[model samples]
Target: MADKVRVAVLISGRGSNLLALAEHKRRDPDRPYEIVLVASNVPEARGVVLAKRLGLRTWSLSHKGMERRLFDQKLDTVLREHDVELIALAGYMRLLSPEFVERWEGRILNIHPSLLPLHKGLDTHRRALLAGDEYAGCSVHVVTADLDSGPVIAQTRVRILPRDDADSLAARVLEAEHELYPAALERYAHELRGAIGEGREGGSDD
Candidate 1:
């Protein structure tokens, strides 16, 4: 496991995707990453509870009164303490400050519950239904300062059914997210490790 990338998953609610990723790691010994930490702003977040149940190291602090960067700084401290190499934003509701994004640029990934570039912000399933779109899906992408506007790594599309409401569509899309995220994260970790290796090996000796 020395070669595995240390990953930290950030969440603000029930951690369905967190469970999915953890299960994938548990079942796949060859995964190129390991879950090192699970942290949240809400002290009672169900995700934090689930992480503890899964025997993962966990941290939580209420973000109610703290400034965005201040809260993120504390969170960053915990992540650094765990030597986190990659961050997966799984239903993490807070908008990260530009400073935080810069600190982990190209190292954060998020799974947005829309095809993305289609539904950028919240209420995506409802918006997709309202827009009369033919499909709704989830996307795994790089986390940029812009909300849900990062470069997509992979996506899974669910057909928008005629009888679907927001809740129905959301339920199906969430299922897609569970399947899409773990696979995308594993792929991204491998590619990132390879890219770093290439950069190091190809560096000029000055």
Candidate 2:
């Protein structure tokens, strides 16, 4: 469909969230997004294999020795080649350069393990547990130059049980992430479509 938002997903691991998004798209034929590509920095990343099995286009570019900006430029080129209109970072571990973040800006989204503004970096669940926090959750936010400091679009919170450890808490939060991410992506897709429509109408003044 001409109006469908073309999407690309970047992954560095198992791509659990990618699977969730793909399944959501499959279950809802009328969803506003079409997953056009899946790319990974690690050539042997399981996500690449999964994407291939799902019959989606997949690209693998090694970032082992390349500079961050150079690698991200390659990624940008691949996304553009696929005509991607939106990007979703699903379990992608690499920190993107400021230039890359600025290039995509509002068009890129990332799902972080913690409620965000709380645990900005890694080991979120363990950090929460160690701090004796009462709640833990996942957040979907627009990707910015700052790490996990972008504007939050959606979040799903889960109670921290008295008997919970990092692993258990992480498992529950991951489930929450799986649900929250797809919903957030759908919301963002609609917003993107509206913005494009507005821009087109504004340009019609010519």
Candidate 3:
């Protein structure tokens, strides 16, 4: 397998995670994998704009165009067209249809604000602050049909100061997301290359 991995990013809003990935790629010009596609349900998604700035291929599809299944089929086609080996979800607000989740399965990953399985959904930073927690964190994990219920790959922890508010905690957690997501993706790409190599060897030897 070639050294650089192919990655596709999916986003609905601000592409913080995508930006993080791009930053990582910039610092390591010799890395084997590079982002090949960026797709967003929102046509004006900032992530798509960011992708274009990075000179990577990008596309936008309206999520309201068809039944969920039809939409996923279109999405699947887009991903395939780009030769995407892995997918990362960044600021995507919609709940992915199960069909699409199953299509990618272990190949998909997402960064969630809270330390997942804890806050599970939105307002994570606020939730943590409201609960009077001393620490807040971000998580990168494999995507499954269950929302934010997949196996975690890595995480970064940030300490919440005594006088911290939601915004402050969120800012720190967002920083963690930046550091964590790219590292998680690198690991995922390395793992995929290994699996592919083994599969090819076994296939040829049979």
Candidate 4:
């Protein structure tokens, strides 16, 4: 763990993407960052149970009762408690407010199911199929309050076959996410750590 980085992950449902991230982290134990935190806005998010089973720290600050300000404050506290250096949003459902976004600006990253600036919101799989997109893909970007408007870090695309439907396209995009997200995180970590030495390489942070 000499060059290890600290990563905290957020999710709102089954942490399939988080699980993938965890698996990738495990694959390279010598690499920077571990899945140090698994948090959910939903109390019953199955991922929390899974994380606990794996003996990882888990938290649920349910969104039902608290206001956004309070909720985000609680989230910030938890993130700080874990000494998180990077924040990854896997299946987190809500839009992060400007305050929270600014608090962790440039340190937050998210994975989206489609090549962004196209389908910015939900139902990307169905929308891509209905719109007859020639290709569907996934994007890994820095997080911003303007939804997926953050600077692009990396992306990978897959052809939309004539026979492809929402479910089929969703599966393919997920595979792309699994591949792209980890690579993007690795590059990001390496560049960040390299900079801590003397800011020698990597493109300017957007």
Give per-residue CA lDDT, model 3, range 1-206, as digits (tens): 64467888899988888888988989997655688899988988877898888898889988885788887788899999888888889887878889999888888889998877778889898899888877789999888998899999998778989988899889888988998888888878888888877776677543
TM-score of 3: 0.94
CA lDDT, every prediction? 0.93, 0.92, 0.85, 0.85
TM-score computed on alpha carbons, candidate 2: 0.97
Candidate 1 runs further than 4 Å off? 198-206
| Candidate 4 per-residue lDDT over residues 1-206, each given as its tens digit | 13466788899988888878778878878666677888889879988888888778898878987789889999999999998878989989978878999999889999999898779889998998888899999999999889788998999998999889899889888888988998898888776666554543444787
lDDT over C-alpha atoms for residue 181 of model 1: 99
- For candidate 1, write residues 10-61 as lDDT tens digits: 9999999999999999998789999999988877999999999999999989
Tens digits of lDDT, candidate 2, 1-206: 13888999999999899999999999997888889999999889999999999999999998998999999999999999999999999999999999999989899999999988889889999999998888999999999998898999999899999999999999999999999999999989988988877776777545
Clashing pairs in 1: none
State which candidate has the highest TM-score.
2
Worst 10 residues of 4 by lDDT: 194-203
- Candidate ordering by TM-score (highest first): 2, 1, 3, 4
TM-score of each: 0.95, 0.97, 0.94, 0.91
Question: Pick by lDDT: which candidate is best?
Answer: 1
lDDT of 3 at 128: 90
